[model samples]
Target chain A: MNIANKANRLTPYVFMAPAAIILAVALLYPIGYMIYASFLDWSPSQRIGEADFVGLRNYVNLMHDAAFRESFWVTVKFAAVVVTLEMFIGVGLALLLDRNIKGMSFLRTIFILPMMIAPIVVGLMWRYMYHPTVGIFNRTLKDWGFEGIPWLSDSTWAFVAVVMADVWQWTPFIFILSLAAMQSLPRSALEAAEIDGASDMQKVIHIKLPLMLPVLIVTLMLRLIDAFKVLEVIMVLTNGGPGLSTEIVAMRIFRTAQEFQELGEAAAMSNTLLMVLMALTIGMFAYNKMQEGRAAKMQAMAAKGTA
Target chain B: MPKIVLEGLVKRYGSFEVLHGIDLEMEEDEFTVFVGPSGCGKSTTLRMIAGLESVTEGEIYIDGKPVSQLEPKARDLAMVFQDYALYPHMNVAKNMSFALRLQRMPKAEIDAKISAVAETLGLTDFLHRKPGELSGGQRQRVAMGRALTRDSSTFLFDEPLSNLDAKLRGQMRAELALMSQRVKKNMIYVTHDQIEAMTLADRIVVMNGGYIQQQGSPEELFKNPANKFVAGFLGMPPMNFLDGEITEKSGEIFVQGQGFSVKLSHQKAEAARAHSGRSVTLGVRPSDLVYDPAAAEDQSLLVSIIVSEYIGAQTVLLCDCGGQKVEVELKSTIPIDRNGQLRFAINPEGVHLFDKKTEIAL
Candidate 1:
C-alpha cells in the first residue's frame, strides 16, 4: 500500500489516541496496582521495599474472617432489600405522575431533588432526622402522645434508617428512567388495549408493565451495583452501627485500612467486591445479548415468511 | 349485527371545532367508509364512535341504546388503528387472547379463539414471536387478529392500511374486504384513500372541511357527485377542472373556455341557460376524453401534448389546453407525438358543470 493509503487508515486511530491514553492512566493503572498490592503483606507505616510478598495469604485469611464475612452478607442483604423497594416505589410514582397537569415539570423537579444532593450531605440530613431524642420524627411521635422510638440507637432501627436514606436518594434514578420509558411507549397500543376490554389496572399490569420490562431490568441492575458499593451515607449516619447491622462491604473496607491498619487485607476485600461486580456486569451483558439474538431470529423468520 | 347512529356529533379542541354536528346512520351489517383528506374530521368521527375520543355534544346509539358516556370496553366495539398497535412485548397469541383473558373466559375457549384467529391470519407459526420481532405486514395481521378475536358487534378501522407499502396495502385491503364479507358486522372504516373507499364500502361517505359533502353507493357518487369537491376527490387521477363562461351563440347554449368550446347537452343546456353569461367551471375525467381524429369541431378539445407516461397497458398524457392543464388516459399502442397538437372528443354525458363562485353543481 502507498504511504498515503496507510496514513488514511491510521488517521482515525491518531484522533482516538488521547482518550485511549487517558483511560490507560486513569483507570487501568490503578486496577493493576491494586491487584499487585493485594498479594503483599503491607502496612500503612511501612515502605513498599520493606513489605513482604505474601502470595494470596490475605485472600486466604479473608475466608476465615467472620467480620469480613458478616460485612459481605450485610451488603448483599442491603442491596437486595433497597433495590427491590426502590424499583416498586419508583415505577409506581412514575405511573402516577406520567400525565400532564399544571406545574407537573416543577413537581418532577422537586421529586428528584434528593438524588442531586451529595451523598455525605444526604447522610447527615437523614442522621439528624433519625436522631433518638431531638429528631423531627421522634418529636412528631411525642406530639402524637407516643414515646420516643429508638431510631439510630438500636441495631435493627439503624439498618432500617440507612435503608430508608438509600432509597430516598436513589429511587429518583429509577423514577426518571421509568417515566421516560413509560412516555415513549406506543400510545396507540394503550388505546387499543383500552378498546379491547382492558380496565385501567389490567392495562397497567398487562400492557404497561410488560412493555417497560427491559428498561426496568437495566435500571434494577444499575441500582443493585450502586447499592453494593454504598458507603458514605452509612458512614455518616450509623458508622456500621451498634453491631455489624449496617456494615456494608464498602464501609468495612474503609475501616479495615484506616482503623485496623491492614492495607493488604483491605485490598483483598476490595478485590473480592470487584469480582462480584464483574460477574454482575457480565450477567447483564449476557442477558442483553440473548435478547438481541432472539430478536434477530424472529426478524429472520419474518423475512422468510415474506419471501 | 347492530345499527349505529350518531346524533349532533360535535368534537372540539379547546375552542376550534373539528366535527361540526355530524349526524349519520349506519345500517345493520353495513360496511360504511368515511373518506376525505387529512384533517377533514373523518378519523375524528370514527374515533368518537369507537369511544376513543369523547363526544363533545352528541349521543351515539348502538342497537337503540345510548353509549356516548360509556368507556370503550363498555361499548362492544373493536378498533384497528393507523399504527398496528400490537403489544410489543407479548407474543402474537398472547396479544390476541388478551381480551378473552381480561373477560375471564375459560382457558379452553380463549385458546380455541386464539388458534382459530391465528390460523385465519396465517400467524400460527409466529404465535410465540413478539411484535417487535415481526415485520410490518405481520404486525398488521396481528393487529387484525387481535380485533377479530374480540368478536365485537361493531368493527372500526382508522386508516389501518395506510402504513403498509403499496403492494402489501393492496393485499391487506383485499383480505380486509374478504373478512368484512365473511363476518357481517357494522364496520365503519375511515381513510383518505378514495380507492379503498370505493372498493370496500357498501356506502361511501365523502367528507370535506368537517361537513358531509355526499354519501351514496360507489357507483352513485362516481356517476353523479353532489358538488365539485365530491367530484374531484372520488376518482383516480382526479377530475380535471377548467374555468369557462356559459355563453349563448345562435340561440344555443355553449360553455366557452381558452382552447375549447363545446355545446352543452340538452339537460345541461337548461341548467346553463339559467346562468348564461355567468362564469362556470367545467369538470371532466381523464377516462372520458376519447382520442378521435375526425371529431366535429364543436364537440372536441384541441390540446398540446406535453408528457406521456406509459404504464404497461395504458398511457397517461399530460396535455395543455390553452392555459389550463388536463390529463388524458389512452391505450399505449396508440401513437402520439409529444409537443404536438391533438384532438380528443368529449363524452357529453361525462361533462359536469359547477358555479364558479359557489363551486356547487349547477
Candidate 2:
C-alpha cells in the first residue's frame, strides 16, 4: 500500500519531467545567461569567461544615460498611444460590423489580412506607403492640390508614421477578438434590453459593452505587452529616425550590442523591457484567475442554496 | 388597461408561411393562454403581440392604435422568456429596476417599487445577489419581479415555469394564479402544458399547425370541443376516441363500433340524425366511464383489464375492448375480479361525436 501511494504521487511528475527539462534548457538557460552577462563588462569580441566582472555598473550607467532615458520614454509613449488607438478603433469597428450584411465573411477576411501578414512584410509594405515622394498619401495629396507632408523625414513626423503603421498592423488583432466576444454574448439579454425601452445606443452602452468587458480587457493587455516589445516594423520604417525620436527600447538594445559592441548594456536594457512585460503578463493572469474564482464561488453558492 | 386586437396577423420566414393570417381580440385585463404542441406558432403569436416579432402582412392594434411597426418598448409591454433572460451581470434589484431606470424614474421611487415587488416575490433577501448566484426557482422569481416592476399595461409569459421542477412548478403556478388576481393587468401566457392553460386561463386558445383550433372557457372547451384535436389536446388521461358508424333505428340514433354500441342522448341524437349512415368518431372522457355491473347494454361498455395503474385515490386501468385499448379512471376502493370482464356505464352528457372526414363536431 505504501509503495502504491508513492507511485501515485510520482505519476504526475513523471509525466511532467520532459516538459520541465525542455523549459529549463530552452527558456531558463537563456534568461539565466542574459542576467549573468548584464553584470559584466562584456563585448562580443571577447569570450564570456574572459570578461571583467562589473557589478551593477551597466544598470548604473543606464540610469544617467540621456539616450537610454529617451528611448525608454519613447517606448512607453508608443505602447500607450498605439494600444489606446487600436482598442478604440478595433472595438468600435467590431460593434459596427457585427450584424449580417452581404459578403460579410469576405469583408472580415479582408479586414484581418494585415494581422496575418509577416512582420517584416508589414514593415516593407508600410515603408513603401510612407515614402515621401512616391507614397500613396503624398501622391493623393499632390493630386488633390495640397502640400505633401513629410512622413518619415522629420523626427516628430517619423514617430507619428511609426505609430500609424503599428496601429494598422495590430488593430485587427483586437477587432477579431472583440467580434468573437460580441458574437458569443447571450442574445436574449439584448432583446430584454430592447423591451426595457433601450435605444440602439443605450443597448450597446448598457448591455453589450459590459458583457464583453472581460474578454476585451484580456485582449487589451495582450496587445499592450506585444506593443511594448515591437521592433521590426519600426526598424524598416524609421530606423530610430533622423534623431532619437522613435528609438524604442528594443531598437536601442539592438544598436547598443551590434553597433557599439556593449553586450552588457544591451543585456541590461533587454532585462528592463522583459521586466515590464512580465508585470503585464502577470497582471493578465491574475485578472483571469480572479474571474474564474468568482464564477466558481457563485456556482458553489447557488448549488448550496438549491440543495 | 388596453385592449389588444390582432387583425389578420401573419408571420413568414422568407417565402415559407408559418402563421396563416391569424385574427384574435383580447379583452381588457383578461388572462389569455395560447396552448399547443411544439411548432404550433403559439409562442410566435405571443411574440408578435409583444412586438418582438414583425407582423408580416397585417396590423396589431393596442387600444385602437396600430402598433405593427412600433418597437417593442413603444408597445408598452413586458415579457418573461422561456429561459428567463435575466441579465446575468446585474443583481436582482438592478434587474428589476432596469426598465424603471430607463424611464428615468426617481431613485427612491424605483427602490420602493423594486422592494415591494421583491417582497411579494419572496426575493427581498436576495436583492444583492447576481443571477448567477441564484437557483433556478429564484431566477424565475426574479424574472417575475422584473415584469411586475415594469408596471406595463400588458404582460406576456412564454413558458416561465417550464424550467422548474414539478414541485416548484406547482408552487409557482399557484403563486402566479394568485398574483394574476391581485394585479389586474392584461396577461397573455403561452405554454404547451394543457393543465396550465386550464387552471390559469380565463380564455384558452387552442392552436395546432399554426391555426387556431378552438378558443373558449375551460368548462365550455371540456364539455363541447369544436374538433377532435381540441378534445384530445385538453384534459388529463385524455379523451378516448373510438371509430364507429352512426345508424338510425326507429327514430333512435346509435353509434356502433368494434366491441360496443352506445345510445346517444336526445340532443346529441338529433344532431347525429342528419349524418346517419355516416362514419364518425365517438369521444368519451376517462372520468365518464364508471364501474357499473348492471348498466343497460346500450349505455355501457364491457372491457378486459390489460394494465392497472393505481394512484393514491384512483386506479387508471388500461383495458382491451376488442382489439382497441381503452383506459378507464376508477376509484381505487372498487373491487375487481382479476379474470372476469368489467362493465362501465357511460355518461350521456359526456358523449362527444365528430365527423370522421373533417374531424369536426357533429
Candidate 3:
C-alpha cells in the first residue's frame, strides 16, 4: 500500500517532466541569460565568462543615446499608428462583410490572403513596387501626368511606406478576429436592436461594437506587441534607412549587435522590448481575468437568487 | 390598439413552402395564441407579423395599413424572444429603455416608463445589473418588461416561457395573464405547449403542417374541435381515438369496434348518418371515461388496466381494450384490480365522431 501511494503521488510530476525540461531549456534559460547579459559590458569577440559586470550601465547609456531615443519614439509612433489604422479598417471591413451576400465565404477567404503570404515576401514585393523611377506607383503617377514622388528615398515617405506594408500584411489578423466575434454574437439581440428602432449605424455602435469589445481589446494588444517587434519586413524594405525614420527598437537592437558589435547594449534593448511586451501581456490577462470574474460573480448571484 | 390582419400570408424557403397562405385576423386588445408542434410554422407566422420575416405572397395589415414592406421598427409592435434576447452588455434599465431612447423620447419619460414596468415585473432592485447577473426568471421578466415599456399597438411573444423551469414557467404564465389583462394590447403569442395555449389565450389558433387546424375560444375548441387533429392536440392525455364502423340496430345508431360498441347520442348520430363515410373514429377524452361497474356493457369500454401513473390528485391508467390501447383518468383514491378487466362509461356529450379517411369531424 505504501508503494502504490508513492507511485500515485509521483504520477503527475512524471507526466509533467518533459514539458518542464523543454520550457527550462528553450524559454526560461534564454530569458535568464539575456537578463544577466544586460548587466554586463560584453563584446561579441570575447567569451561571456570574460565580460565585466556593468551594473545597469547599458540601460543608463541607452537613456542618453539620442539615436536610441529617436528609435524608441519611432517605434512608439509606428505601433500607435499601425494598430489604430488596422483596428479601424479591420473592424470596418468585418462589419461591412458580415452579411448574407452571394459568394461571401469566397470573398472573405480572398480578403485574408495578404496575411497568409510570408512577411519576407511581402517586404520584397513592396520594395519592388516602391522603386524610385521604375515602380508601378511612380509609373502610374507618370501615366496620369503627375510628377513621381520619391517613395523610399525620403525619411517621411519611408516611414509611410513601412506603415503601409505593415498595415496591409496585418490588418486581416484583426479583421478575422473581429469577424469571428461579430458572427458569434447573440443574433436575437441584433434583431431586437432592429426592432428597437436603431439605424444601421446605431446597431454597429451600440450593439455590435460593445459586444465585440473583449475580443477587439485582446486583438489590439497582440497587434501592438507584434508591431513593436517588427524586424524582418523593415530590414528587407529600408534596413532602418533615411536617418533612423523607420528604425524600430527591434531593428536598432539588431544593428547594434551585428554592425556596432555591442552585445550588452543589444541584450539591454531586448530586455526593454521584452518588458514592454510583458506589460502588455499582463494587461491583457488582467482584463480577461476581470471579465471571467465578473461572469463568475454574476453566476453566483444568480444561483443565490434562485436558492 | 390596432387590429392586425394577415391576408394570404405565404412563406417559402428556396421553393419549399413553410406557411401555405395563412389568413388570420387579430382583434383589438385580443390575446391570440398560435400553438403547434415543431416545424409547424407558428413561429414563422409570428416573425412575419413582427416584420422580421419578409412575406412571400401576402400582406400584413395593422390598423388597415399594409405593413409587410415596412421595417420592424415602423410596424409599431414589440416582441419577446424565447432566449429573452436581452442585450448582455446592457443593464435591465438600459435594456427596457433602449427603444424609447432610440425614438428620442425625453429622458424623464423613459425613466418613468422603465420604472413603472420594472415595478410591475418585480425587477426594481436589479435594474442596474446586466442580464447575466439575473436568474432565468428575472431575465424572462426583463424581456417582458422591455416589451411592456414599448407602448406599441401590438405585442408579439415567441415561446417566451418555454426556457424556464416548470415551476417558474407556471408562475410567469400567471404573471403574463395578469399583464395582458392590464395592458390590453393586441398580443400574439406562439408556443408548442398546449397548456400555455389553453390557459392564456383569449383565442387559440391550433396549427398543424403549416396550416390552421382550428381557431376559437379555449372552451369552444375543447368542446367542439373542427377536426381530429385539433381535438387530439388541445386536451391532456390527448383525446383517445378508436377506429369503428357506424351501424344501425332497431333504428338506434351505434359505433362498433373490436372490443366495444357505443350508442351515439342523438345530435352525434344525426351527424354520423349524414357523414356518408365508411370508416369512422370515436373520440373519447380520458376525463370522459368514468369508472362504473354498473354501467351498460354496450356503452362502456371493457379494458384491462396495464399501467397506472399516479400524479397527485389523479391517476391515469393505461389500458388494453382488445388489441387497441386506451387510457383512463380516475381519482387516485379509487381501488384498482390491475390484472382484471373493468368498465368505464363513455360520456355521451363527449362522444366525438370523425371521418377516419379525412380526419374531419362528422
Candidate 4:
C-alpha cells in the first residue's frame, strides 16, 4: 500500500487503540480465564496450572445437582418478584413526587438515601429491623394488639424478609431514573394533552407511561441484571438459610466455591449466570438500536414530507 | 357561542408578579391574537385562559359561567403548541382521535372524525406514521388537525408555526389563515411575529413590559398607533424615529432636528403646537418617503444614499439624513447611485409625533 493509504487505514485504529486495550484487560481477560478454569477440576488448594483437565465433568455434575438447580430457580424467582415490585413502586413514587412543591429536593434526597448505603450495611440494618421479638415493626404490631410474627425464622417469612430488604435497597435506583425520565419529557406535549381534554389518569396512562417506556425498559433491564447477581445483603442477613428459601445463585456459587471447595462447579454456575446477563444486555442493546432506527426513519419521513 | 372573559387575571411567582390584573373579553367566534416580544407575558395570558397556568388572583368566565377552578380538560378548549406536541408514540390518526376516544365516543364516529381531519390536512397517506417520522410542517398540520377534530368551542395556538423554517412558516401561516376562516371558532393565538399578528388576527393585542400597549383591528393599530412602540412593532421594515424638537417657525409648527426639518400638516401642527419647544420624536414609515427632486425645502429631506438593497420590485435605500440614519423604500427602477445625495418628500398625512420621554403618539 502507498504511505498515504497506510496512514489513512491506521488513523481509525490509532484512535480506537485505548478502548480496545481497556476492553481486553477489563473484559476479555477475566472471561477467558473463567472459561479455561471451568473445564478443569480445580481446587482452592491447587494452582490453576496444576489442576487436572476434567473436560465436561463439572457441567455434567451441575446438571444433576439438586441444590444448584434449586438455587438457580430461587434466583430467577427472586429477580422476577423483586424487579416487578420495584418497578411498580418506584414508578408510582416518581409520578407522585414529580412536582415543584417546597422541600421536593430534600424529599428526593431522602428517597434515594437507601440506594447510596453499602449493601452490607443495608443487610445489617434490615436484619435488625426484621427481629420478630423486639424490632420496631413487631413492637408497633404488638402495641396495635397484633401477634408478633416470625420474620426471618420461618422459610416463607425468610424469603419475604430478604425480598423486602432487596426491594427497600434497590427501588430507589428505579425511582431516580424514572424521575429523571419524567422530568425530561417534553413539557409542551403534556400541556397539549391537557388541552386536548385528557383527564389526569388518562394522561398518566396514555402519555406519561408510553413516553417513559423507553427509559423504563432500560432501567428494568439494568435492575433485573443486577438482581440476578445479588448476594451481599442476602448473605449477611439470611445466609441462604431457612431451608434454601433465600439461596440466590450468587450465594450458591459463593458457597459452592468457598464452603464446598468445588471451584470448577462454582465456575460452571458463574458461567451460566453470565450467559443469562449477557442475553439481557444484548436485548437491551437491540431495543435501543430499534428505537434509534425508528427515530431516524421518522425524521427522514418528516424531511421528505416537508421537502 | 361562548364569550370568554378574563376578569382581573393575575399571575405571580412568589412575590414577583408577571401578569397584573389583566381584564379582557372576547366575543363569540372572534379571532384574537396576543403579540409581543419575549417575556411580555403573552404566553402566560394564553396559558391562563387554557387553564394550563393557574390564575393567581382572579376568575375566568366562559359563557358567563365561572371556570377559574376548572381543569383544562373540563374547559372545552384545544391548543396547538409551538413544538407541534404530537404524541411521539402514536400514529397521526390515533393522535388526532385521542380526545374523542377519551370521551368514549363511538368507534365509527371517531373514525369518521379522524379521516375527515386527516383528509383536510392531506395526511391520509401518512396516517399510520408516528410523529417522529413526520417532518416539522407535517407535524404542525397534525397538531392543527388534532385540535380541529376535537371541535371545541375555543381553539388556542401558541406560536404553532414558530418551529418551522422560514419558507415552511410562511406556507403554514397561509394555511392557518385559510383554516381559521373555514372553522370560524373563537380562537386566541399567541406569537412574537408581527406579520402573523397582522395577517391572522381580527384584533391584535400588542403587549410590552408585561402590559398591553394597544388592542384594535390590524388596520387601526397600523394607521393609528397609540404609542411609538406599536407603530415601530407593526410595520414590515419598521418605522424610523428621528430625535427632533417641536419648534415654532414663523407661526407655523415644524419638527426640526439634526439633518432635516419638515413642516407638520395642519392636524399634526395643531397637536405639536401644544408642545412647542419640547423635544419630540418624528415617526415616519419607510413607505411614506417618496423620491422627489423639486420638492420644497421644508417638505423634503436631503439625504446621502449609503446603501441600496434591491428586493425585486421594491428597493430599500439606507440613507444618512444629517447625522440620523433613515430608510426610504422606492421603486427598484429608480436610478440611484451609492454616495449620491437625493431629496425625498415626506407624505404630510404620514407624519407622526410622539413625546420623547413617554413615546406616546400625539
| Maximum-DockQ candidate | 3
A1 Cα displacement, candidate 1 (Å):
6.6
- The share of true interface contacts that also appear in candidate 1 amounts to 0.74
Q: Which residue ranges in model 3 land beyond 4 Å of their true spot?
A: B275-277
**TM-score for each prediction?**
0.97, 0.96, 0.98, 0.96
Kindly list the per-residue Cα lDDT of model 3 for residues B312-359, writing each as its tens digit.
999999999877889899998888787889899999999998888899
Q: What would the per-residue lDDT of candidate 1 be over residues B1-362, giving only the tens digit for each residue? A: 87999899999998999989888899999999999999999999998888889999989999999999999999999988899898877899988988888999999999999999999999998999888778889889999999999999999998999999999999999999999989989899999999999999999999989989989999999989989999999998889999999999988889899988989888889878989988999999988899997898788888987788888999898889989999989899988766678889999999999999989988
Give the per-residue lDDT digits (tens) of candidate 2, residues B1-362.
Answer: 99999899789988988898888999999999999999999999998888788899889999999999999999999989889998888899999999998899999999999998988899989999999999999999999999999989999999999999999999999999999999999999999999999999999999999899999888889889999999999999999888999998887899999998989999989898999999999999999998899999899989999999999799999998867788899989988995789999999999999999999999
Cα lDDT of model 3 by residue, A111-203, tens digit: 899999999999999999999888999999999999887788899999999999999999999999999999999999999998888889999
Model 1 chain B poorest ten-residue lDDT run: B334-343
lDDT of 4 by residue, A134-242 (tens): 7877888999999987888888988988999999999999999999999999998888888887777888999999999999999999999999999999998899988
Pairs that collide in candidate 2 are none
lDDT of each: 0.91, 0.93, 0.93, 0.91
Against the true structure, candidate 1 reaches a TM-score of: 0.97
In candidate 4, what are the lDDT values of residues B143-191, reduced to their tens digit?
Answer: 9999999999999999998998899899989998998899989999999
For model 4, what is the C-alpha lDDT against the true structure? 0.91
RMSD of each: 1.7, 1.9, 1.1, 2.1
C-alpha displacement of B148 in model 4, angstroms? 0.6
Candidate 2: which docking quality band?
Answer: medium
On lDDT, the stronger of 1 and 2 is: 2
Candidate 3, residue A27: the lDDT equals 100
